[model samples]
Target chain A: MMRALSWQSLVAVLLLLAALFQLPLANVPIAMTAPAVAWTTLILVYGFLLAGIGADTFMRSRLWRGIVLFLCAHLATVFLFTLISDENGLARPGFYVVLAACWLLAWRCVEILSGLQPRSRAGRIILALIIPAIFGAWILIIWEAVTRGLGIPFILLPPPSAVFTKLIFSLSVIAADVNQTIFKAVLAGYLMGCASGFVAAILADRFPFMRRGLLPIGNLVSALPMIGIAPIMVMWFGFDWQSKAAVVVIMTFFPMLVNTVAGLAVTSTMERDLMRTYAAGYWQTLFKLRLPAAGPFVFNALKINSTLALIGAIVAEFFGTPVVGMGFRISTEVGRMNVDMVWAEIAVAAIIGSLFYGGVALVERAVTFWHPSFRNGKA
Target chain B: MSEARGNRIIPVLVMLIAIVAIWYAGTYFMNAPFQRDLDRRAGVTRSSGDLFIATMTQPKPTLPAPHQVATNFFENTFLRKITSNRSLIYHAGVTLSSTLLGFVIGTVLGILIAVGIVHFTSLDRSLMPWIIASQTIPILALAPMIIVVLAAVNLTGLLPKALISTYLSFFPVAVGMVKGLRSPEIINLDLMHTYHASKAQTFWKLRLPASVPFLFASMKVAIAASLVGAIVGELPTGAVAGIGSKLLAGSYYSQTIDMFAALVAGSLVAVLLVTAVDVVGAIVQRRMGARPS
Candidate 1:
């Protein structure tokens, strides 16, 4: 019995206490303002959850806990939104009870999922996917509820829903920003920067003395706030995507150089001797062993540069632009007090960044499939 | 030993000279067109030697010569009052304060969170994914919004900038420290268990010491990131001072030389911050009876 007293239970107990002492859920009871169907559903879900709490450990199965959690979270969301819709009504303690209960129940679900060791491969994948989904979903729910229920000024943080609505409506605008920043500047700069860096690394490898001399400098350059050169690049190129692309190129260059050089250096003397024994020429060993081994390192630089390029291209727009870019929109929209539009741009950037990173990571997995991290199919 | 050091030093020196030479040549070529346009306007032809010197001396040459930037860097950094807005040191100090403040706050928060994650399996499972995801979401996009909103609330100045810095610097330390805290070998864990050491004792006596190197390494990365955040934070705010504002002001007025100087000073600050971390890390490592690295 003592073993069953998890943090989840303690949180639930605290939430229950809050609910018992609940003031008006809003300025008025949720029922008078909310539709019958919504309040009735919320009541049904909470009642079911309360009944489960009354039962022994809410069932010993993962599926049941997940269902209760899902139902509880969804209806609690419903309850919170219905209360929020009554715009003039201020939330009282009762609004928090639903939020707290939903969060705690989600916590319990993730905790169970954390301990889950489903024997089947497909079951494992689903479990792995569901845990993070619940965690992320709850975060959005909390953000929405607090923003709407507490009536946080929209300029401070438009609720995720409003931001999404803005996003849906402004698809054309976002697509233009994407084309200007990602498709044009980032892509051009990334390809040029990475290719040049890779070439420089290979060239430097031929001269051991130059390699030693350059490596430390390269490391230093990599660590510098390379973004500071955005203005200079803007000056050199112009007030357009070309300038942003130039910034991205310079931004991506050093990291790739440093990482690729280090990767090339990883071919130890023992490996070189083995290659020599095979009567392989310098080019042969490099292409066969060194470059293959450098794939992971090269891919690491790629991953870093992908994020760096996005940031560079966008921030460079802050300097000057042709009136269309993620950075331009964000800076302009904020001044216009179009906070929702700003957030929508941020969301688009987040999605583009994730896709770019995910794509690079996928290629890395396929290329470096022989690396130790991937050898056992580790996540 | 000296000969080996010489071998390493010579190549670097050569590379430096080569880069400078290239810079000088590049300046001549890039700025030559501008100089020709000037000469064409003035209705005079200059010899190539005279033309090269003219291009290098252009007040707003398309690409300033290395010497122009060096002189500008020197005058702003050393020849001016440190308190003056025209001084690079003044701007750097402004940027550095937020960087340090943010770095300190971020390091503390990160180390605490890392400790929690290390001790709690549930946290490790739930939080690690998000920590990684947080990094992928370019927080810089929000910098402009953060500054504006905070300004609207009358919460301007160092705090807003520091908050951005804090968010930027937090991830590296947390990620590194988590790996560090969990780095003690299984054999060491067994030894602790055999002695009946409590979790607190084990953490203090074994885990904490073991994490110092990792802490300092990530601190270096975190500090650099903090500087970047501090610098960028100033950009959207239309700030009156700081390295970022200096860059913004320079760009606005086309003070190409001042912009280059600020860029240099910013990079110098980055180098110094990283070196300071390295030195402190070394001292800490030595005090902990580790071999000098």
Candidate 2:
């Protein structure tokens, strides 16, 4: 099994090799009239076509045949390069040749790997994990290759390597920004906003008049553009985390209120009747019946608010800020022509937002384990 | 039912009345002190009694009374804009062009990508997560980078700002569409399969119609977001026209009323655009026989 070179595995290995070669080898002076056809790229394309051909030819053991075809195809490409190009180092299609090969090889690997039908649970899991990782990595590869290979200016779109380097170098500044935006402003505002929304929802539910009066007001508030509100919040709260938090609160409050209201209503009449038969009052019924029923809706609000809070904080920072925040860094750095620094801020935001969303989801799973959606593993 | 309807109308009316009453009281009580501060800052000589009189007689406070804003809006849009600078129509035209261009681009790209995802399961899983994750990186952060990158590539023009609008607007469309496309009832899908329909046929006859509601709903959101994107695009780039530049200019000059007026204009544009979508949605919904209650 290990000895067998499945077309995807072969392509992956070849691309890996091509990427390694892309760095220093191309810089070596070679005199050739036309840049040598991107040999590596051609080989990978050949591999892809061969695998396709194999899939058509071998009906029962197509996978195995596809693997063999890919290996053979790449080998033929390498052999052709040796034959057509001079050994005297006359032509240096060097890095371009390698990059082309790497890209084609990577693409073929993705196609082949994505085509495979997983036969086991672990196989499915691995395939699920691997395919996206490969796709994302290739995007980064293309980004790195295009920027470095073409010598694209760093101030424009910095190479991925440069972004990573900036990520390392400006770890402290990035961390401080993250702390200011995510920790102090976003988290605080998110908590306060969500809590107030939830409380207001409960109050609205309790008072018939409030429900009739407030829901429309909530809708209007939700529709108020963040751009309009953020500056006003800055004016009201001063230029600090407090102002940003106010904006977050305004942005997040409506979603939570709407979702929680809808959630509290999720308890069916049958369920409510059952609670009534048990001699439960409104609060008792709410705690026992409606709250649990509302779990999914509340969780939905939390998930939505995670992203909304981040957005509110960032946009609020644009209006005015005390210097150290994610939004401040992103806006200021772009002005300074520090594209890599901007990318670093973005990477931090992505990771933080993902973790925040994932945390809410995880808590939802734990709390609502008995809910049919979670129990059946549907969502 | 009539009682419930009456109950609903009453609350709405009361809320409106209460809001107006508060505004009136705030104007009456808060107006004097606010004007005194303004006069003090402006180095105008006035006794406390004179300040109160000035506050009452002053055409409008710095914040502009609601009536003043309405009159300003009419004067700028209808009366003046038929001629000069600070014309609401002129600025709106600048902003609207970018918004519409961005909306068209974003919608097309979103639909194409969504189709790709719907057809391929692997692409669905892999692409959907990234698409969702893409939004996590705030557009505010991405906008300047996009501007700078495009500038370096010698691609600065109206198109760049429009492209920023497209970037911001497309995500909602893509996500909304993915849901819409996947929303075909299982029985309906099986029925299509029974008829031996091709993939394209099934898509056209069933999924496309099913997605109309979702698409229009998202278009409302996408259009609003696109307008915002165009405005924000104007801000960093120092674009001479558009509502965003107007707001920035207003802020820069401490012309609070001008800032507010521009904001009102922008909000009106957004509201009008959204209302237009809503009307179209209603028509579509009626045509599809899914009219709202």
Candidate 3:
């Protein structure tokens, strides 16, 4: 039986076939003659497309499709690297046609593989990882192709290849910057700010007057931009990580305070009445019921503060710094036209910020496993 | 209900009074160092009562009394011409225009992308992660790069700043709208299909209306972010006008009192912008036949 085909898959297959015979799929305006490297890469790309088509027609299983997609993605990367070496100024119509075809087919493979319902947990996890991996790889492939093909200046927009090279070459510099900003400023500020906020929130809960007084003031103070207070902090604490830490503290404190206070109030009257009937004191009730009830809200603040702390520390470094942090590197390097270094720093920020947020989320999962939102199978 | 409302107001008033008193005390303590230093340098023997008055009334206070900032706000806003570079009103206008422009651009871009993501399942999986990734890269870190790159292209002033604002503001709208567009009941969607509604018609008749509340909520967040973007954008350009420039100038001069006044002014602007959005949201919702929540 002929399996019914979707329109996108059909179009993708047709275009792949068309790419097989197209001569000079891309033209390099900058190069007087097409280099052997470009020709070789193009042939290899076409060859991979042919293989992809073969797999699409012959194989229906998710495993084969996923493996073929990865191979094709790798081929695309090789093609981009070669094109950059050839100094291609612009991509011709044929190049775009082939690119679109490859993209569509890759997307199609991803769609099918994602749709597959793996029976085992391990299989499911593998499928989940494979899907986003392909998706993210395509983004890089597309970005690389566009920038290289258009001959965009490195200063305006550097290719991911250049960015990756910078990241590898300048590992020490990036590591030092991360150590200064994230380890020193972010960690110090996050712990102190969150601890103080949590303590203050508990105290506020015990005193109605403090709760009423503090919340409104916190709300107003939270709205004050970091820029306004950062220079002042520098004035007070000197131009080191301490000032940045102060900025982070101010940025982070109110959010935790507000969220924790709200979380503490979330225990319903019925729960309190039940606790009273059980003859539990405030401390016992708080430890057993109220604090546990507040876990999700407290986690929400922690997650929010993770990003805020990084942002506050980095932004504060813009005003005053010891020339060793991410923000300082970016500001100073941008002036020197070293856009690649800035992007490398950005990549570092993205990775660390993501890991920090992920770590908090993982902890939240463990702590708030009983939250209604976590009732689904996901952890 | 009225009694409960009155009870709540009493605590809030008491809290406000207590805070103001604490603030005055804090100012007295913080500004004393400068006052004491001045007194020592001038070899002036001042009484404790006179020192307290000196701290509160210093022209360049280390920590300005609330009344001092208020007086500065009044004088700078009303005494100076609105067009003068010295006036806070003038600087605020520059910041506000860029903020408004950026907010509009970001809102439009966000809605368009959200529609695309909602319509195309592939884009939802692929593009959403990148969008989220874009935000996690601190915009402050990117702001300088954007300013320099745009300057190379001979693009400057409002457009560049507005673009930065767009960068900051678009995420909330896109994220909120995605959730909002998908918020309609499945039964309602099925009913639309039973009526043989086309995709466009269904989107227009059901999804768009359902997303209004979400759009407004996200707009509030977007507007505030846009303001921050506008301020950060001004910083990189060394712009002569804007609330950001005012802050920078104050810091450069070590005029702590003036810096605090500018900070207060900036916060007030943010609050006003959010309130304005709320008012507009209420008006739009009322006209749309949705009962006020």
Candidate 4:
């Protein structure tokens, strides 16, 4: 029989010891009558710890261990919600117990997840998605409990609950901002900027003069603090999506140019000689051989520009805008002390930015399938 | 080599001339509307040459000529006292100090977190994705909130800006270092295991050394990004100092030339900062017995 002497058991024992102390869960005394949730949560966690400590060999399998640890985590999270109320602050000792319990449980979960080897493709896919989701959810839960429990001022940090509530209620505003920032400015500028850069890179490859003169200037321009150009763009294009799009264009163009140029340079002289021996015309060689080889680098630029376009659009909106945009709302809302709305806008931007980046990365994986980095099945 | 350099110079010079010509033409085109309006109000139509001159020399043209920006840059950087508020160098210093502080803090934090992630398999699975997700959030969107929140706590000036820079720059370093630390071959790791080397010794002797090149590369990106963070931080604070403020003030007053001058200064700072990191990296590599490639 196992000694139950693992770090996992050790942590459970330490938590068990800590639970015997009759300390308040928070700084302020919680309403005595409302202790049902707290008591149930505590009992569940204690029960899980006991079971984990006493479980037999079969229960020690990766799957069984993962389920037990996750159950403990769920109970502990519920305990946190109970402990962290508006009238209560974290009691140092109780907080420590909760933290240790969660850390150990999370570590156990990680161990199990890493060890488990699913044979089926669908199982692997589901497992992959579930791991990060749980991790992300735990982060949000912790954020919510700590902020709400500590009674941090809304101005400082609106609790995640409040932020989510604001987001749900303010859908119209967020939709409008996304339409303005993403659909108009980000989309337009991303296309124009990346397209122009690609064309310019191709032309530069054709002419030594253009490459010599333009690449250095492009480097200098790309390094220009993009935000600094927003105000000037506003002056030039007036207060609309036009100005924001201009900023995005300026921000994204050079990265694409530089990356594409570098991508073009990646072709080996030996490869070029082979193409020449085949008597392939310049365009034929470029399209068939050189361009295909440059897929990874070109996709790298695309991914980088995807994020840049979003940022440029949002930051440019800070300078000037007409009525609706993410940056406009953020800038204006903060002035009115509508901090929740600012957070809501930030949430919207974060979600959209992630989606935009993910979309590009998905495309990259498909297009650059032959690249060595993608060949490992790791992605 | 010299002949190749000469050949490159001629094309580059020709391209430079072409760009200048384009700039002059763009300036004339952009400023023509204003110039034509002025001429119309004055009840006199000037020749094309005179109109071009007027466009180039306009006090507050829509698009300033290259020479006008040069003059503005020269006047701000060289003509003014370094201590003066109008001086570009003074503003750059303010921005640079915050950026440097933030970059240093970020580098340390990044290295520490990278070490944690590499050592703790749990962190690798759990925290790595969050770290990447954190960056995709466009922290600049939250800059105003950060500034206001910090101000509520009576923390102002460089600290808040530095905090923003830290948020930005730490990611690149952490990601880079994770790759670096994991870069050591399995054979090398097996050797360490056979030697019965402790974790700390293995880390110090093998992983840390392997991570040096990655750390420097990340630092270069981080430093440049930290400057962007500093500049963005300066924007919302409405501060009376820094390059960001200069851009803001210039925008408020429609001083396009002044804004362009600040842009030039910011770019120069970025280039210099990156080069500085590269130089230090080369020196470190040499001292570490890595040949200069």
Query: DockQ of each model against the real complex?
Result: 0.75, 0.45, 0.53, 0.68
Runs in model 4 lying further than 4 Å from the true structure:
A1-3, A24-38, A48-58, A83-96, A377-379, B190-195
Instruction: Categorize the docking of model 2.
Output: acceptable
In model 2, how large is the Cα lDDT of residue B163? 90
Q: Per-residue lDDT of A187-291 in model 4, one digit per residue for the tens?
A: 999999999999999999998778987887777666657668999999999999999989888888899999898899899999999999999999999999988
Residues B160-265, candidate 4: write the lDDT tens digits: 9999999989999999999999999999999999999999999999999999999999999899889999999999998679998998888888989989899989
Output DockQ, candidate 3. 0.53
Question: By the lDDT metric, which is better: model 1 or model 2?
Answer: 1
Q: Residue-wise lDDT of candidate 3 within B1-293, one digit each (tens)?
A: 99888776777788888878998999999889888999999999899999999999988776789898888888888899999888989998999999999999999999999999899765776678777767766767788888898999999889899999999899999999998999999999999999999999999999999999999999998998898888878877885789888877877887777777788778888889988998999999999998877
Q: Which numbered prediction scores highest in DockQ against the true structure?
A: 1
Worst 10 residues of 3 chain B by lDDT: B121-130
TM-score of each: 0.96, 0.82, 0.93, 0.94
Task: Put down candidate 1 lDDT per residue, B29-101, tens digits, no spaces.
Answer: 9999989999999999999999999999999878889999999999988899998879899999999999999
Candidate 1 residue spans exceeding 4 A from truth: A1-5, A28-42, A51-56, A86-89, A377-379
C-alpha-based local distance difference test score of model 3? 0.83
Instruction: For candidate 2, please provide the TM-score of chain A on its own.
Output: 0.75
Error of 3 at A290 (Å): 1.6
Interface RMSD of each: 1.2, 2.6, 2.1, 1.7
Greater-TM-score candidate between 2 and 3: 3
Q: Please give the TM-score that candidate 2 achieves against the real structure.
A: 0.82
Q: Which ten residues in a row have the lowest lDDT in candidate 4 chain B?
A: B121-130
lDDT of 4 at A185: 93
Candidates ranked by DockQ, best first? 1, 4, 3, 2
